[model samples]
Target: MSETVVSVRDVNIYQGSNLVLQDVNFNINRGEFVYLVGKTGTGKSSLLKTLYGELPLREGTANVAGFDLKGMNWKKVPFLRRNLGVVFQDFQLLTDRNVHQNLRFVLKATGWTDEKLIEEKINDVLDKVGLKSKGFKMPFEMSGGEQQRVDIARALLNSPKLILADEPTGNLDPETSDEIMQLLFQICKDYGTAIVMATHDFIVINRYPSRMLKTERNRVLDSAVPA
Candidate 1:
């Protein structure tokens, strides 16, 4: 069995007087692909924020990447993010920087020095996302899919244990979305990197079946598997 990478116990989150989620209990095992689906305002983003330590847990308990979400330290936010690979619908890449420079920036900021070693690691991760030739291209020069691949490459620089994606394919065409989905799945299968993606794309969910978790009627529904 894969290791349980994320564990939540009756987690509740709120924004002002609004209770976004109630009693959200679930487990995400290593190498598992999970889909978080719901209406536009059903706490998807909030959950991702909590996982990455952007928001504090107001009630219950949560653990992600071995850090306590309820009592997470301020200084450890960077450390938590380093263990998590985060992707967004909008490809967040520096337009002025080449793919190599972008990846290098993350390495240098994350405390990776040693020019020779940094270059080697950058090359290795670029290759991992099937973008070895893209190292010299600018973000705008690359195709949308390729740009997202570069984003994935940046996320993988730290060899994160889990990938938390927020609407990862929300801006892509159907074909491009399929390609991105396949890429994410392949990475999880090959590297045992568990993934929890929040998206409204039910078409992709229908095309590629995964363990589904949805927020409905003030509760989290794990409906993909028979209980």
Candidate 2:
């Protein structure tokens, strides 16, 4: 049986005291790559925030990477996040650090103490993202796409079970966007890691279609089933 990485049911998502989405329901399984699409204020980001424990799940139940989201305190947020990866539209690489240092920071923050294992894991993820030889290069030394690869490599530091990517391809050119899309899909297939990517790029969506969860009219519509 396929293991579920994210399970949300009858979820009422809120930003502060205001409700953004009602009766949201979905299940993202291992190796599944699902798209979260919607207009700017259609609660796409809010939903992702809820899943990542940034925003509280006020009225529904959710399990992300085996961590219960309901009543999740700030103390437990880091633990939950450790099992999940989050990719942003901007590369968000530290300007002061090289690619290797960027990834090293994350490992140390996540409690990795062995130097040998850290080097091995960083090299492994860099290789996975096609940046095996660029680790010593600074963020500004590389192209936008290459920096983005480092960001992805950082996400892979812990071998997360799920990745929540917010507009990962948003800042790239068409070709670069395609490359990132391919890399993300490859990661999903190769590692059995589930991905829930939020994107507004219909062109990219059309180029590589998958199960879609759209937020519209204050609700989430699962296109994997009949409307």
Residue-pair clashes, model 2: 0
Q: lDDT of all the models against the reference?
A: 0.89, 0.93
Best-matching candidate per lDDT = 2
What residue runs in model 1 are displaced by over 4 Å at the alpha carbon?
A: 224-227
Per-residue alpha-carbon lDDT of model 2 for 95-126, expressed as tens digits? Answer: 99899999999999999999999999999999
Top TM-score model: 2
The total of clashing pairs for model 1 equals: 0
- The C-alpha TM-scores of every prediction are 0.95, 0.99
TM-score of 1: 0.95
Model 1 lDDT per residue over 59-152, tens place: 9998898888888878988988889989978889988889999999999988897999999999998998889887999898888888888888
Q: Cα deviation in Å at residue 94, candidate 2?
A: 0.9
lDDT against true structure, model 2: 0.93
